[model samples]
Target: MFEAVLVANRGEIAVRIIRTLRALGVRSVLAASVPDRRSLAARLADEVVLLEGRTAADTYLDVEAVVAAAKATGCEAVHPGYGLLSERPDFAAACAGAGLTFVGPSPETLTLLGDKVAARDLAIANDVPVAPGAEGTTDAELAEAARDIGFPLMLKARGGGGGLGMRVVANPEDLAAAIEAARRQTAAAFGDDRLFVERYVENAHHVEVQVLADAHGNAVHLGERDCSVQRRHQKLVEETPSPVVDPSLRDQLTSAALRLMRAAGYENAGTVEFLVGEPEEGRRPFYFLEVNPRLQVEHPVTEAVTRLDLVALQLAVAAGQPLPFAQDDVRFEGHAIEFRLNAEDPWRDFLPAAGRLTALAAPGARLDTGYEAGDAVPSEYDSLVAKLVVHGPRRRETLPRAAGLLEAASLDGLRTNLPLHRAVVADPAFAAGEATVQWLERDLPALLD
Candidate 1:
């Protein structure tokens, strides 16, 4: 095990990692921006390195500064909790070049899976199904390719994640404008303007399989998560043992996910997302979406069900340890749900709400957060302030518990989607596990009113 490590991200994830590091008897060095110097993670870590910036560009996303901080602190490895530079292949390679272990997959694997078009091709080569799509580098090329993909297709940024740089074009008349807008957004978000088009599955369920792999080629799947409850293609809620998947479908999803991991020589914690659609006249049940080559935001749900500490596992893997268990050794019990508590007002088009947290409370759930009642939520960063994870013996039992937790929450000084979450858990469609990707957008208005 590593004696010391640096957490290369901020907010709740950094706090989450630092807690795990303490449990594992590893010293944690937190890298914090100027604004985050007094944050919860910074206070909790054994040592704090103040990166020289207030914005993400010169702070968390600065690979050179992060590596330098780790080296200066004598950290043997770096754990990128998630988001920002977590999925960047160059960042991984920089760590390698700096003689520090990155607690994720190899740079080659990151590069291969980070590109959506390449990942789709990889899925196809492995016999995993993918939606029909074509990659194009220019506006004219993309526009030309859309003619063949047909109407109601999705315009996506090849290098984008977190639901940015994506648009749904219902007709040819809007293709050019959508393409330009997606390109600009993609460039601003990911520094890549490449785009692709794919046929959209309107009512598909977004399911993802979690896999843990070691450097020695041993890997195991930790079942699946139902992330269909989304807004703007970004997941809002996630749960394990999807209510819609049966034994057979679960096996298929897990097997396909494992196959992709093995083929890519993947290591550490990663997620394979898929779009699962009801069988149409001739279509298959599921199509490969993309690979998230890092610890996911919703990893707590998987940990609750599998009874495993993923951060510890990632640390072990990076330390050259083989997986302690195999596929059959893994046992999943009960159902777990995670609700992302973001500082946003759902009734007002989900506008970001940033302010001092005057009063805060999270009851009836396990809370993971980086802020307290006195912390300030800056407008510069992601709106997510905390996560509430609930576990129960079965899926049916989780809904009411989740609802109670949301209702009992007493956040103040900033508007939140607590009411929205409360509404979702009580909604019959969601309670019945029939919520699709479009359910929030299509049905939330009626529930709110």
Candidate 2:
């Protein structure tokens, strides 16, 4: 075990990492921006190194500052708790150069899986099914590719995934504008302007397999998660043992995920996301989406079902330790659901809000959050303020408890999407596990009205 580790992120993830470090007896040194000096993560950390800048660009996203803090704090490793610089190859390389272990995949793997286009090609080479797609460095190339892929194709940035630089083009007339917009967004968000076009499945489920590997070549798939309940391509609710996926489909998803992970020589915790279509002829068609090469925001739900500490696993792998368990040893005990509570107003088109959280009341269930009462919800970063995770013996038994928890929970001083989450859990389609990626957007008007 490491004597000390630097937590190089913020919000609920930062706090989550700190808890694991405490349990493992690893001293935690937090790298916080000026605005986060008084954050709950800072209070929980054994030590704090304040990054001078207030904005993400100069602080959390700055590779040099984070590395320097880890070195200065005498940390033996760094754990980037999702987002920010978590998937940045340069950041991982910098940590290696500084003789500090990065508690994630190697830089080489990050470089390979971080680019959407490259990952798609790798999947094809590994014989893993992927949506028909073509890559382009310019609008002309993408425009030509779109003509073959046809209308209703998705335009996505080659670098970074999280629905940031993505657009759905309904027809040729909208291609150029969508291309320009996607390019600009991708360039600003990921420092890459390259784009790709692929066939868009009108009705699909967003299912992802959680896989963990070690440097010693041992790997296993934890299971699949259904993140179909979404809005604007962003996931709002995630659950394990996707209510719609049967045993056969689950085997295919996990097998494909393990094959890709082994082929890429991936290590540590990573997620393989896919777009799954409805069943036809007794089989569901699933296509590769993208790989997230770091810990994900929805990890807690997986933990609830598997009874595993992913953060501990990441640390063990970074220390060059072999996986303590094998494929057969892993078990999925129950169904778990996680609802992302963002500081946004559902009535106003889900506009992000910021203010002091004057009141907060979560009576039961697991609530992972960085802000407490009297804490300010800043507008400069991600809108997510907390995650409410509920677990039950089965999906049917889980929905009511999750709904009740949301009902009892309260947050004041800023608008929240709580009402929207309430509506989702109570909706028949969602409760029946029939919600797709487009369900929320398609039915939002009726649910809200």
**Quick one: best lDDT, which candidate?**
2
Per-residue lDDT of candidate 2, residues 1-449 (tens digit)? 89999999999999999999999999999999998999999999999999998899999999999999999989999999898889989999999999999999889999999888888888998878998889876789899999988889999988887898789999899999998898889888778888899999878999999999998889999999999999988999999989888998999899999999998899999999999998879889999999999988999999999999999999999999999999999988989999999999888988899999997767888889998999998888989999999999999999999999999999888999988999999999999899999999999999898
| Per-model C-alpha RMSD | 1.4, 1.0
Provide the TM-score for each candidate, comma-separated: 0.97, 0.98
Off by over 4 Å in 1: 281-284
At residue 395, candidate 2 shows an lDDT of 92
List the candidate 2 regions with Cα displacement exceeding 4 Å.
none
Q: List the lowest-lDDT window of 10 residues for candidate 2.
A: 358-367
How much is the lDDT of residue 180 in candidate 1? 85
lDDT of 1 at 334: 96
- Residue 416 deviation, candidate 1, in Å? 0.9
